[model samples]
Target: MFTKKVVVAYNDTDLSNDVLDYVHEILEMHAEIELNIVYAYEHPLENPSPFQRNYDDGAPEMLAYAEQIIQKAKNRFVDLPNHVEGFVYDTGPAAAILSHAHDHHADLIVIGNRGTRGLRELVSSVSRTIQTKSHIPVLTFPKFVQEEFEEEYHK
Candidate 1:
């Protein structure tokens, strides 16, 4: 039996669930494994005042959103026999995930790449940054585009 300590960057977006599901299936085969699922609680850089928008209090709104997202992701691993924990960090995704992995002595980091177009592509850069900065291996699930996953699988 071997052990693996994984830090999964959790998000509940449909694409995010695809990666999370993939990880869960892998962990099921392990005799000993621990999952540290983390969600980076980030407020938009352009939005300074949540109060001015739809938030009652900016900080709490941010935290609450993070909590909800992490909770949804956690539900996916409920049946797994391995130890699973969830966390939310009010920092950039790459920085927060890397720091938590290093501090917790995680053996690997798993993140989902939401392959977006135009302005959104900037976000995928975080995965690249984490891979470069981390001493441990980072596995990123490339976002499914169109019928690529289905087409490849059917063959």
Candidate 2:
């Protein structure tokens, strides 16, 4: 299917930036795409209550950091013709990303693979979980894979 709306699960890591690079290359080809950059922050100790919506002492700082990450990611696409937006959610990574994708009726979800080795690879990382649960297509490559491909292509 044609990709017009895409949700990018960004965490501000170098690996995450690689995913954005891939999106940038895709945007060069398809400027009609609308991009959504999302960063989900879940408190490791506290599970948010659905009704209460309470936060621990560190929640505010964590939320602020997430906002910053989203902003930085958005800035990278400033010159692009595509419509771009940023979102910071205080929720589980996979759940928050999937919710945003579903709400936006995204055609694809772009993410970064950490390239976890051995048992870690078998376990569910955020990228793997999103790929398994998302209804739409999910595109991802290992860390630095985009840069490696670009180097080869330019040669």
Candidate 3:
């Protein structure tokens, strides 16, 4: 099936870049496609410790950072003919991406699987949650898998 609208989950991480690299390959095949890049970030002080109760929430800074990253992501597609747009949300990543995809009627969701293990995995596995919960088709690119693809492509 032809994919017209795609929702991409980006957060300026290496894993997220891997997803973008894969998306670049997809763009080569689909000449007419619309990309909606979404970056969701949470406030650093959302769960501040008791000792840091008076610290500024830094929501504005975080949002600004998110916007910068989204802008950089948009720049990556600037030369391409496909339409590209970026979005920044002050919320959880998985929830924001799913909601955005649904709201925009996206045909696909492209995300990077961080492959975090142990405690970190339980605390922050956005790709897994998104894949399971999203009604739209989800494409996940793990870091190792991307590396392998690059290696093969160079050979």
Top candidate when judged by TM-score against the true structure: 3
- Between 2 and 3, whose lDDT is larger? 3
Candidate-wise lDDT, in order? 0.81, 0.86, 0.87
What local lDDT score does residue 44 receive in model 2, on the 0 to 100 scale?
41
* Regions of model 2 farther than 4 Å from truth: 44-55, 145-155
In candidate 3, position 138 carries an lDDT of 95
Report the C-alpha lDDT of model 2 over 1-155, residue by residue, as the tens digit: 28889999999888888889889888878889999999988764566576545546677788788888888999999888999999888888899999999998999998888877777766758888888888999988777566878899988
Please state every model's RMSD to the true fold in angstroms: 4.0, 5.5, 3.9
Q: Could you give me the TM-score of model 1 versus the true structure?
A: 0.78
* TM-score of model 3 vs. true structure: 0.82
In the range 1-155, model 3's lDDT, one tens digit per residue, is: 47999999998888888788889888878868889999997756666789987665676777788889999999888778888899998889899999999999999999988678888877779988898899988988876765778899988
TM per candidate comes to 0.78, 0.81, 0.82
Least lDDT summed over 10 consecutive residues: which range in candidate 3? 54-63
Scored against the true structure, residue 73 in model 3 reaches a CA lDDT of 94
